[model samples]
Target: MNLLKIENIQYSYGKNTPFEKEVLKNISLEVNANDFIGVIGHTGSGKSTLIKICNGLLKPDKGQIFYKGENIWKKGFDLKHLRFKVGVSFQYPEHQLFCETVKKDIAYGLVNKGVPEEEQESKIRQVLKIVGLQESYLEKSPFKLSGGEMRKVALAGTMVLEPEVLILDEPTAGLDPKTTKQVYESLKEYQAKTSSSIIVVSHSMEDISEYATRLIALDDGNILLRGTPAQVFSNTERLNDMSLDVPITTSILSMLAQKNPSVNTNIYRYNDTKAEIIRLLKDVKSIE
Candidate 1:
């Protein structure tokens, strides 16, 4: 069964007002098992609104959101349970942090669900490690940590539940390059182990292209393109027209192809780009 599905969803910011503005129009999406979906769009493209609707945090003006074939908005559908199953961490998760310590913050959800104290402690430690934090830091105030550290804590809080579908919005917004990579690696590893689906909204073409199995590009509240990273990035002209740039690796490969006919310009991943370059170097050595 599809993990989550959005069917012809429409949303507006205001109703019957002069300032009313529609943010989404007939948006449809299907998330399957073990799917890693990347959503990209400029400001006001409704990416945030769409994700919020997926977890029952926001109601759509039209259409329905389904989790495991059940309409999320249907009466007595257990919205609380749906939220627990489909975890969502917003762009600035630190805003939601209110506990005195990181451990308490991460344990809040467990407490609500009435999980055993011992299991909560174990899950807290496990998720902390996944987020690359030391156990010693658990007692420290989340408010005292750096921006990147706080973000990690927030991520751990959501991940501790081991939700079937994880949604993150700019999860790496405040992190350095190394930290960003570590966060993505942790998420990738978590998904691999649990077969859970992930939906990430990011502006970084490089990171998204490398990690996401599929890509969705939104423009003016509508889906402009959707496909594998290579397939979507292949439409350089269309993306450029939409003010979106392809991954740096893809652009570099395209440049290499222009100079060398044998170069494969379809590469969108950094590792693949490096491998292609190494193969070319070996070919040159053999020729010489």
Candidate 2:
């Protein structure tokens, strides 16, 4: 089922002013339940604007946003309820963390929703572990943790609510390789466990290639492409025209194919590319 649908959404900044400029034009898409959607684009492509509209943080000048088939912008719609269902973690989520302790920070949302104290505590602990944080760290101030830890805490804050749709913008922007991998793994596990829709906006094609089941590429405030990773990454020239690159593994395969035309260059994921390389090597060995 489509958990969310955006229809002909148009949005502009500084509307009716000298600085007025449209950031999104005729954006339309449907987000299915349990979808892991990766949104990619160069700077100023309206990627962030599009997500904000989805989460009800920004209203589109023209179009309708439907949550579970109900128009979110309808006069009597409960926007607050929609926000809970479609949780968003913006870029630099750590900057938004404000509470006495990590526990409190993560529980703020649940508390607002009037979740029982016992339930809030249970969820806080559960989400902390999901984000790879130790139970001991829950008492520490959010400011006292490392950059990666802070980011994880911010992520845990959203996960505690168990939102049906989680939207993250640059969730792994400034972490070490180890932390980045852990974050991706945690998000994957979370999606699998909850069967929730996940939307991630990232610049790293590698992340998209590995984790996203679906990919959306935007340019000039328009969706240039939308498909599975294999389908979208296969259009290398088009992505390049929009100032984007395919995954490193795909690039490697492309180069290998140019050097030895017999090798398949159509693969996107690392594992698939690795298997293809192995198969080609085995075939050459058998011929020898």
Candidate 3:
């Protein structure tokens, strides 16, 4: 089932001023359970605006959003419940932390939602373990932790809510390679175990290739394309024209396929392209 749905969403910023801008124009999309969707686009493509609307942080000027098949704007709908159902981890989420200790920070959200004190403590322990943060850190100041540790603590804060749909905005931005790999892999593993739907908003082509099941491409506030990473990154010309870079991994395979058209390079993903190259070489050797 679709965990989140957007229909003909239209939104404008600074609406009555001379500088008014239309950010999202009739955009429509859906996120199903267990889907890791990577969203990318040019600078002004409205990527951030779209997500804010998706999570109900900002109401749309027009159109409707449904969560789990129920209209969110319907009479007396549970806004809080819906938010808990779809948790959003903002960019620089760590800075939002204000608690004296890591345990308090991670448990902040769960506690505010009125979960029993005992239940909240147990849930915090479970999520802290899930994110691989030690219980020892629970008593330490969040500001004193390493950058990666801080990111994990922030993520754990959100995860403790146990939302079915998780949205992360630029999760790996500004991290060292090793840190990025570890955090991303942790997220991937968590999804594998929980089958939670995740939407990642990032402009990094390589990250998209590594994490996204499907990639959504946007330009000038409109969706240019939506498909698997292999499919979206396969169109070299189109991506270039849109001023977006194809993943280096995809570019390598694309070059190989073009050098010998026998292996159609339209296959954009890394593993599939590798298999295709091996298959083509085997056939060529056999003929020789």
lDDT of each: 0.92, 0.92, 0.85
Error (Å) of candidate 2 at residue 81 is: 0.9
Model 3 Cα lDDT, one tens digit per residue, 1-288: 798999988899998999999999888899998899999888888888988888888888999999988888889988888888889999988889899999999989888788888898888888777778788989999999988889989999988888888889888778888878777787777787788989998878887788899888878777888899878877778888788988876677667766776766565555776787789789889999
- Residue ranges of candidate 3 with Cα displaced over 4 Å: 263-288
Where in model 2 is the C-alpha error above 4 Å? Answer: none
Q: Which residue pairs does candidate 2 place in steric collision?
A: none
- Candidate 2 on 1-288: residue-level lDDT in tens? 699999999999999999999999989999988899999999999999999999899999999999999999889999998889999999999999999899889989999988999778888888888899999998999999999999999999898889999999999998888999999988988898899999999999998789999999999999999999989999999999999999999999988888789877768877898899999889889999
Top-scoring candidate (TM-score)? 2
TM-score of 2: 0.97
2 against 3, candidate with superior lDDT: 2
- Residues 164-283 of candidate 1 have per-residue lDDT tens digits of 999999998868999899899989987987899999999999999999999999988899899999899999998997889999998988898888899988898999999999998999
Error of 3 at 249 (Å): 0.8
- Candidate 3 has an lDDT of 0.85
Window of ten residues with lowest summed lDDT in model 1: 185-194
| Model 3 alpha-carbon miss at residue 225, Å | 0.3
